[model samples]
Target: MNTRPGLSDTEPAPCLRIGLLWHSVNSPNLGVGALTISNIAIMEKVANELGVSVEFIVLGWMDKSFPVYVQAPNVRALALNGRACKPGGAFSAAVGDCDLVLDIGAGDSFADIYGWRRFLYLAYTKWLVKRAGRPLVLSPQTLGPFKNRLARAIAAFLIRRSDLVFARDRMSVDYARDIGVSRKIIETTDVAFRLPYEKPSPWPGPKEKTVVGINISALLYQGGYTRDNMFQLSIDFPALMDRLLDYFAGIPDCEVVLVPHVLSHRAVEDDLSVCQQVQRAHPGVSVAPAFRSPSEAKSFIAGLDFFIGARMHACIAALSTGVPVAPLAYSRKFMGLFYALDYRDVIDCAAETTESALEAVTLAFGRRDELARMARHSAALAQDRLGIYEDGIKDFLASRIPNRRPAPVAAKSRLSA
Candidate 1:
């Protein structure tokens, strides 16, 4: 066989080229990072079991300041952003080269609630992959809550075209069916549940007291994106955070920590800013350090005796690690995922009053030992449920790629060394 130019004869070819759409290994939102890390673990496992060499091409919202940190030699991030949507751009070429595309829709971007821009971003990625005649798979993520006709149609069209659709919760499954999409939907738990974390060595804290962590979403702190209660929750979010803090502060020997999950530079998206402000209002409250990766955030949360948070993934990090967690739910995704895990110690922020929500959280904290038992039990259930998803992934990857292949060119643009 003639050696292709620029391709050394000694270099082994990758058996498969996989494109992960809406997958960002580096993001201020640790939740997104959690999904990215968990999904990659699955892909790597599937590839190894199939005896295939795989190269992952991660494509999503990338910025120069936040370089991709995939921590894999075979993974690379394309510099192209929205420009990749065009027919003749590098994204198109990247798609044409891929053997398969796994789109997690940024966990729940398949829903129209975030805005038209995000929905279209996900829709176009699916459309372009299908147009390129490549296999498109919807990695386990929330499917939909498309409010309008146009959004519904667009979502249904992509869901229908996808080679496989894995819904992370039952509500997503129901919503997909409601939108007239029944086929190709596999119900599973959030990938964050399976996200890996490092066990932190004993961190210096008041060892005799209950160490509590509260993750306050800056978006909700200022009343959603518009800063005017855009999520339409009945309760006032700012008031709830204030009340929870005061309640915890009054408890003797309780060491409270402000943990920020979404660390975006954008004022509204930056949890650290809000957490700092929160700490000032109530002195003696410690602030958690800014973590470089999702695993780091999970590890810090793992040390907490109890965690209550508005961010679903932050709560997930706690509960999944056997820390008693009471999720401050602002959306249906919370109820869907946790309930499916057989964990019901959730505070419905969307529906409850600020006072009532605080009350529920206080009650949950009072039952810390019980919640810990349930958290451990739920973690076990999560493992059992996630096993089904792992099996599904194994079958899908095994059938998609052959055992033998010619050596392919190495990726030029790398996310991390």
Candidate 2:
């Protein structure tokens, strides 16, 4: 970890430098984009409290399907993928220039499930940061389902090296310990809980109808990246989707809108493409216009009366906004996160048959009001959980960055003074 000499009686430094790893505001996967936007907001809040201006360097890859949103003067976005991660490259200089490096593993890429290419890409960058002697913090995220001994060994090493580690759910916490991570682990909620958004000015869906927003993940729809039932799910995804659309159509005064979260350019990976196909098949269903930013997508999602999503962050967008959601989960991350918040409305594709899954969703729809009430409560709890994460961040920054101003003393209260 890098440190600066104390200012003694002098005021704090003019700028605090931070390097964000494995994050980009331009990712086609809006889930990663949401993490980027929300993290910046959180850092800004803490910076205000410390009475300091922050100069952030966002070091990550860029996806051509999306436009860059980190255009703020305080933030410098650098695409550091491929050969750019070497010692003398921009990635190294960025780490050297910053006071701290915080890695989120793009929220879940720390594991080997994505294959060696991605694992190496993420791991090598962390190695660069450490070799540069910069302090690294692993922000709250799903740590791993490593599955391979070597991958688990590497993950455990990184967890051990990080100055501060945070796991966003109980399962991640348990996994961290299982991997021999001895550091004190703080359990916190996802940062997306605090993502800022504006409500849609005018409701886009049909008025006086139950507006249901559905997010379909093209990756899952195509059966993982291979399009050969890669995840080995017992239920048929295409059939399930068809059934959902037809079933929702049967309800009187109900409208369904397809909300695509991943706007990848590749046809198989792009959610909007699948959504367009759904629109073609069911002419009554509407597909949302492509959003320019994560906030925009979340804003549109927030306006929905009810939401069912395959994308974890899209579901998060709904949950954090107090809009009730039923998550069509295919991963442990979903079950861990939702169940941790005690708002269990996740319909798992692995465990239940299509009929059983639909039954659960149907029951949840009937109890949407109750779900909404629980969602409101859970949102509050999410913030409360985030306080632990916030405090850890504050303590880390305060220790490294000197204060610009003195703490104010409180005035004594009087009964009638």
Give lDDT: candidate 2, residue 81: 73
TM-score of each: 0.92, 0.91
- Candidate 1: regions farther than 4 A off: 1-14, 201-206, 403-417
Worst 10 residues of 2 by lDDT: 408-417
Looking at model 1, report the run of 10 residues with the lowest lDDT sum.
408-417
Could you report the Cα RMSD, in angstroms, for every candidate shown?
4.3, 6.7
User: Residue-wise lDDT of candidate 1 within 1-417, one digit each (tens)?
Assistant: 224243455656447888988888787788887888787777767666655567778878875555455666677777546676788788889988888898888887888888888788788878889989998989888877899899999889889999988888888889888989879688888887878777767758747888999999998888878888878887888888888888888989899999999888789999999999989998979899987778888989999999989899999999899999989887888899999888998888778888888889999999999999999999898888777788887787766664436536433222221
Regions of model 2 farther than 4 Å from truth:
1-13, 200-207, 403-417
Checking candidate 2 for backbone clashes, the offending pairs are: none
Quick one: how many clashes does candidate 1 have?
2
lDDT of 2 by residue, 1-417 (tens): 112355443544446777989888588888887888777778877866755557678888887656786566567778877667877898898899888988988988888877788888888888889999999999889988788899899889988988999888999999889988878888997888877788667755657899999998898889887788776666778888888899999998899999999898888779999999988999989999998788888888989989999999999999988898999987778888988998898988888898998888888989999999989988889999988888899888877766433323211111000
Which candidate gets the maximum lDDT versus the true structure?
A: 2
Evaluated against the true structure, the overall lDDT of model 1 is 0.82
